[model samples]
Target: MDVVEFLSQRIAEDEAAARNLLNDRSVSESGKWYERRVLLECEAKKRLIGIVESARQAALAAMVRHPEGDTPWIPEAIEWTTLSLNALALPYVDHPDFERRWLGT
Candidate 1:
């Protein structure tokens, strides 16, 4: 598959994994043992995921309605996805590899 198709598949997989983790918060808690603060952070991540999903759906609908290229919806969907991914990584900002992994520093 092309890069775009590969990337799309990866994103779908990542979103699915995030949803699974959100559903099974107990597994994560057992691994890291987060307190109330982290629980709230998880909730925020869940909301971000929802936002990303909504943006993706909107983009897909737009693509279907207007097959003629050059639409702003694609970029808007990308922006939402990037912002949500960044927010998802915020809880790990203090990690040693955060800058290298997430920020590409």
Candidate 2:
């Protein structure tokens, strides 16, 4: 799927995983450290989604403003930002919708 869809799925998974961690019986034995870490990861994913969405919006505006493709740098910037975002998806390499290009594999 597209980046937005993929990131959304990942964010949901992270939220679910965090919930499960909180519900686990071993939490008392493990302390709150792990739970906090998981929550942080979920938050980080949310932030990444926001940033990527903004980048996408900027790219769309740039395209609309330069329909003739006169500004080549805009596309290059988009490509670089996309690749950077894709790299963040490496942790989800096994996901069914994960694209191999994300890993350059």
Find the candidate with the highest lDDT and give its number.
2
Q: Write the per-residue lDDT of candidate 1 for residues 1-105, one digit (tens) a residue.
A: 322233344445455665566577476665434333445554655666666777777887887788886686687786666655654555555644344344433
lDDT at 64 for candidate 1? 78
lDDT of 2 by residue, 1-105 (tens): 776678778878887877887888777746557777878887887787788768867987988998998877777768777886787788888888898877865
Worst 10 residues of 2 by lDDT: 27-36
lDDT of 2 at 24: 83
The lDDT of each candidate is 0.56, 0.78
Task: Give the CA lDDT, 0 to 100, for residue 5 in model 1.
Answer: 36
TM-score of candidate 2 relative to the true fold: 0.81
With a 3 Å backbone cut-off (N, CA, C), the pairs that clash in candidate 1 are none
